[model samples]
Target: MAGGVAAGLVAGALWGLVFVAPRMVTGFSSVDLTAGRFLSYGAVSVLMLLWAARGPRRVPTGSQALAAIGMSVLGFTGYYLLLVLAIRDAGTEVPTLIIGTIPIWVMLLGKPEHLLWRSLVPGLLLTAAGLGLMMASPHAGTTAAGSPNYWRGIVLVLLALACWTAFAILNAAWMKKHRDVNATEWANWLGVATGLGALVLWLVAGSPARELAAQPQLPLFATLAVATGFGSAWLATILWNVASRRLSASLCGQLIVSETLFALVYSFAWDGQWPTPAQWAACVLFTLGILASIRAHR
Candidate 1:
């Protein structure tokens, strides 16, 4: 249990880096950022697979590889694109708030057969109240520093939330069905798939060429990409798997709140602004709601 708690905290901290990385390269659009970040992720994943395969690890079949790639599209490529766009158009607060609801969403969608309506209702109400507080808070749209489209950002983040919920549930199902594949290996494969997805996005969607033509900060961009790719995406994936292995489903669900906590901390630090009074209250409410939901699920 202590190991699970430690892994959850570390994973949350590492995952928080994603929220701040988009800020560092605001000059690039979300598409460009996704491309660069996932390319790095793909490269590292390849290296990982090569090293692991040397130790008698089984390589994935073509069909299994394709399944992983498709999941990576939903979980990594598309999700990052939407997340960065949300952070760009709104602030971290609203987007993180929406994302913070993912655990509840996963439980609602993934385990509907086992839900207890009595506890579930109260849990949902608390979650709704918590989200309402965040929406009504004065700090809701102020944290982005320069973003201008809060409504658009909110919608994008909700989409990201759905994408992630689907990814989490489906990924778990896949792993359960294929016990031969270890978590680290599966993560690396997803990274490879994300790279492929990013390449397609780069070819068809982004303005990376123009963004670069306009005196992009190459060094800073590279550093941010590596941090997000390796630290947030790769390291967080591994640590999360560790926690998931050790913790019960309900406790693991509650622990996801740490991601929102760390993300909020990093967002405030980046902007050199303290959370407003309402923001602080909202945070408390969100924590309570998450706890309630997890308890209900249990």
Candidate 2:
């Protein structure tokens, strides 16, 4: 269980890089960034799949393939598109706060036996309050003119939250039912699915290549894309699978709060300043919530 918790934390640290990526490449549309990152992710996944195939493993049937595609669409590709759209249109705070609610949803969707209402409710409330407090920080504020479609952005992000909650719960259920399906292989399949979706997105959105060609920061953009694709998407997915298999859905959900914590740390680091007192207090609350959730399992 401790190992699972650590895995979840490490995955969160990797996933936290995603929040910084958009800010790094502000010129690119959310779709463009999503496409490029997944393209790179797909490329790496192909190599991994091929390497893994050399070993003796059970081949997946049609149903498993369909499941992988479903997970990829809802969890990876669709989720990314909506998340990017939300961040672009609504600014980061709203989208992020919406995403922060994923743990609550995950707990609700998880196995009933794992949920201890007594401890779980307080932890979730604390987590929500901490998330709200984080928004009060200067770092969460956006200077851009208000998005005309702010409400649309909220809807999009909420949809993303739904997609991810489904993915997390369903993926965990699938893994639990099929113990033979190794985490690495499953993660690779999802990566392949995301890559294919990226292709479709690129085709429908008028290739991110043209957008890339027009930008002077091509090298920087490419670097960020590859780095995030490999580290944030590919590797993080694998680590998340490991944690998912080892931890209960409810516990795994609470651990996701670590992503917000790491994101705030990254934000403060980017600003070349330490966290404000309120931010630090929010961090404490988030940590306490995680601890409280763990205690529920006992």
Candidate 3:
């Protein structure tokens, strides 16, 4: 359980990088960024699989391969595409706040049969309080609520939230049911599937290769893609899988608050400014929520 908690926290830290990643390469289309990142992940996964083939790694069966593809679409390619589009349309604040409710939804739906509802109240309340603080913070930015694009962005974010929430529950259930399927192997399979899906998305929607090549920040874009692909997508998936297999889905869901916390830290660092008192307090509340959830689980 300790190992699982640590893994989940680390995964959150890595996953947080994605919140700022699209901003870093603002010139690129969402499809390009998504494709580049997952392509790198797929490349790495393929290389690792080849290396492991010399040893005794288990290859996924046909049914498992199909499952990987479906999950990759839900949790990786489709979800991220929608997220990038949401941020592009509506700015970051509203979308982020809406997405922040994911832990609450997951906890409500994924609660263990043995765990009492009262045990979850403290964690849920603390998390909600943290989100409230974040929403009230000036740094969260304001959106034009009346704009068509804003509503569209809100819709996109909600869909993104739904995709990931479903993924969280189903992925946990899948990992728990298939105890023989190790975390690393599952991550690799998903990586390959995501890469394929991202490739198709890119081919269909990304800018032409010549136009992308002409961009001044191409190298920066590539670096961010590779860094996030390896750390955030591939490695984080392994850590998350480990956490899912070891912890209840509700506990794992609570731990996702760490991602929002780390994302704020990264966003502030990138802007070369400190967080406001409200933001700092929110971070504290988020930490308390995770601890409360951990206690409840134990």
Candidate 4:
């Protein structure tokens, strides 16, 4: 359980990078970024598989392959595409706060049979309090509330939230049921599927290669895509799968708050400003919520 908690936290840290990645490459569309990142992830998976060709490898069955593709869409390609669009349209803060509620939903829905509802209250309340502070902070709500784009972004973010929340619960259940399917293998399979889906998405919606090449920040875009693909998408999925296999989904969900906290840290650093006192307090509360959740789970 301790190892699972650690893995979950580490996954959150890596996942946080995605929130800032879109901002880093303003030249690229959301589709381009999504496609590039997953394609890179796919490329890495292929290399890894080739390197392991000399050793024993477990090829997934048809059902498992189908499951991987569906999960890849819900958790990787579709979720991220909508997230980037939300950030582009509504700015980072609002979308992040909405997504931050994922933990609450997961916790409520994925509660363990042995754990009492009361046992979860402390963690849930602390997390809610932290989100409240973040929402009330002056740095939040950057997009004008009245704007059509803002509403559209809100709708997109909500859909993204639904995708990921379903993924968290279903993925955890799938991992628990299929204990023979190791985390690394599952991650690789999912990566391959995501890559395929991302390719289709890119071919359909991504900016032209010529246009992308003409941009001054092409190198920056490439760097961000590869970095996030390897670190955030591939490696983080492995870590998250580890956590999901070992911990209850409710516990794993609570740990997702780490992503939002790390994202805020990265965002503030990017802007060359420190978080306000309210933000700091919110961070503290978020940490406390994780601790409380861990204790309850134990």
User: For residues 1-298, could you state the per-residue lDDT of candidate 4 as single tens digits?
Assistant: 9999999999999998888898887778889999999999988887777777779967899999999999999999999999999888888878888888999999999999999999999999999999999999988875446566998998999999999999999999999999998898889999999999999998899999899999999999999889999999999999999999999999999999999988888888887888899989999999999999999999
Error of 2 at 109 (Å): 2.2
- Per-residue CA lDDT of candidate 2, range 1-298, in tens? 8888888889888877776677776577787888888888888999897887788655668898899889989888888888888767777655676687788889767845745577688788889889888877675645322668787888888999999999989998888888888888888888888899889988888445666798887788789889988988888888888889998998889888888788767756765778778878888999998898888865
lDDT of 3 by residue, 1-298 (tens): 9999999999999988887788887689989988999988888888888988999868889999999998999999999889888877877666767777888999999999999999999999999999999888877755445566888888999999999999999999999999999899999999999998888888999989999999999999999999999999999999999999999999999988888888778877876888889989989999999999999999
Give me the candidate number with maximum lDDT.
Answer: 4
Across residues 4-92, which tens digit of lDDT does each residue of candidate 1 receive?
Answer: 66776688788777877888665677888889889888888889988987898777799898898888878889998999989888877
Query: lDDT of all the models against the reference?
Result: 0.76, 0.81, 0.90, 0.92
- Winner on lDDT between 1 and 2 is 2
- The C-alpha stretches of model 2 lying farther than 4 A from their native spots are 136-139, 208-211
TM-score of 2: 0.93
Q: List the residue pairs that clash in candidate 1.
A: none
Better of 1 and 4 by lDDT: 4
Candidate 2, position 72, lDDT: 89
Distance (Å) between predicted and true CA of 122, model 2? 3.0
Off by over 4 Å in 1: 112-129, 143-148, 208-216, 245-251, 288-298
Could you tally the backbone clashes for each prediction? 0, 0, 0, 0
Q: All candidates' TM-scores?
A: 0.85, 0.93, 0.96, 0.98
